[model samples]
Target: MIVITAPTGNIGRHLLPLLLESAPAHDEEVRVVVRDPARLPGAVRARVEVITGSHGDAGVVDRAFEGADAVFWLVPPDASLNPKDAYCGFTRPAAKALAAHGVGHVVGVSALGRGTPLADRAGLVTASLAMDDLIADTGVAYRALANPSFFENLLEDADSIREKGVFTDAADADRRAPLVAVADIAAVAAGLLLERSWTGRDSVPVLGPQDLSPNDLARIMTEQLGHPVRYERQAPDELYTTLVGYGLNEAFARGVVDMKRAKDEGLDTGVARTADTASRITFEQWCAQTLKPAVLS
Candidate 1:
């Protein structure tokens, strides 16, 4: 049996079916841990057992892990003041549950630049690495899916583009950072679960396609939308205030600023080599396929 947490989330929606298809057909079962089964798309609900409960709920997590051979785990980012404590509190219980249940393998959705000086500037990626380490300590075989920034974040700037013809951030418009499609990340995660060969504690970094700066992104969007779009660097304090005004709490806002700082400092840089890792999707294709639709919508 395989258990999936956060099944209705961005990656999970794409990953669940792949997991089910990959499972051995005889008596294997695919289960999803969800807060409300109704929230799941009707198609997904039809295919898997929906165990309703919070990820942090001991009884709920334990129930989902029962007889499960492997699990896919991820935690949604929180902007609360006590963000770290909240993360540890939520993940620790689940780790304990996985330990108690003797689950064999784990595939975790984490972020890049963890376990380095860049970690502090990488926002929640740092906390996620810590969470992965905690889970690894439980003696379960683990794979941490360390994905770079998601191209989907561009969607948040749609309103800004429509009104201001551009979006503002804290990075130099010329600096480039690799961006990945959430679908590609899901594909990689699903592949790992199905293969289940690389065991023990390991981090799998998924670099989507290429490095792109905000200016490059704006240029791509302009060509796609048939309208002018541009990038501008906001003052750090102004960027902080804007994020807070956008309803992100202080801690998350700080984390966002720190991530921009990391990009500006070149902490997110890396060369793409397809040999040592999995194949990745490109930014231009992502723009044509995913970004264009979201912009038009």
Candidate 2:
């Protein structure tokens, strides 16, 4: 049995099929832990057992993990409090439950630069590292997919990009931060679940093809969209206030601002990656292939 949590999100939605296709011929099963079965996209809901409930719910998660050979787990941040506590608190019980259930392996989602002291003080990257440690102590074989920031985050600024021919952030103009597509992340994660070779590893950092600064993204966007898109450097306070007004909790908003500063300081860069180990997708490719269509529509 292979169980996937947050199965409706960016990674799981693309991963479930890959997992099913890779499984050995036997009494194999793929289960999806979702908040509402009815809300799942038609393709995904049709393929797996939809265990409906929050990933944070002990009973729900407990039921999802039963008799599982492997599980893919990740918790979305709560925009209502200090996100670190919420992340640790949510995963602590689930980790304990997985041990009790005797799960054989777990592939979890996390962020990059986890243990670096230079990581943003308010960033959830630190908290995710803490969760990775707790999960490992459960004695279950674990692989944390340490991913860089997503190229998909640009979608959040779609409206502004369309309206003002620009998107804004606090990142420095010259620093190129690694940005991976969710498709590649899901592909690698699904591959990890079925392979037996990488079981005991600490964490797998999925560094995408190349790093891009705000200016780089803007140029890619402008070229791909056939428009004069530009990058605007917003003040940290303005960024936080804007995010808060958009309903993000103040702490989460501030954390993001701090992270942008960290990115500017080059804290978001990771060690060099070999092409064979991870699939690499560039920012221009991501924009031309993914973002342009969404923006034009």
Candidate 3:
């Protein structure tokens, strides 16, 4: 049995179809822990066993993990809590449930910066790494997909870009770092869950084909969208204040600021792209295929 958490999310939504189609050939049964079963497509709902509730809930994970062989673990963003509570605290119950249920393999969605000088101070990224540690200690074969920022993040600025020909972030205009497509991350997760051939714990970085700066992204967006586009660098304090104004916990707001600060300072640059680590998606391609449609709409 294979279990998936947050099956209706950006990553999980893409992952479900891949597993449903392929896992059957491997004699695997797919189960999903979700808050709302109706959010699942009708056809998908029929294909998998659904455990209704938050995966962060101990009772939910206890039931979901039972008889499971491998699990795809992705924590949904919960801005109401502090970084530690949102990440590690959410996983603590599930970590125990994994050991108790004897589930052997787990592939979790996490961030980069493990083993770096900045990782310890990178706020949310730090909490994500600690969550990976908590899961690994459960004696499961764990692979934390250490990813950078996502191209999908730009969707948040689609309106801004459409109206003003601009996108915004806290990163310096020239600070280059890897960014990934979430579909690619889902693809990597599905592959690991199906094969389950690897043992022990490690991070599988789904770095996109190359590192791109904010200016690089703006240039690509302009070319792809057939219009002038520009990057707007926002202050970290402004980001924190905005997040807090949205009713996010003060600590969580601080975490968002710290994470952006760390990324701008090269927390994501700790990993070198190799054939094994590099994923096959470029920002330009994403802009044309994904961002263009969103912006044009």
TM-score of 1: 0.92
Report the error of model 2 at residue 223, Å.
1.2
lDDT of all the models against the reference?
0.79, 0.80, 0.94
Tell me, what's the RMSD of every candidate?
Answer: 2.1, 1.9, 0.9
**Tens-digit lDDT track of model 1 for 38-100:** 988788788788899988788999898988888999886667644565466678888998999
Q: Model 3, 132-182: lDDT tens per residue?
A: 999999999999999999999999999999999999999999999999999
TM-scores for candidates 1 onward, in order: 0.92, 0.93, 0.98
Which ranges of candidate 1 are over 4 A from the true structure?
24-27, 270-272, 276-278
Query: Which candidate model has the greater TM-score, 2 or 3?
Result: 3
> Predictions ranked by lDDT, top down?
3, 2, 1
Assess candidate 3 and give its lDDT.
Answer: 0.94
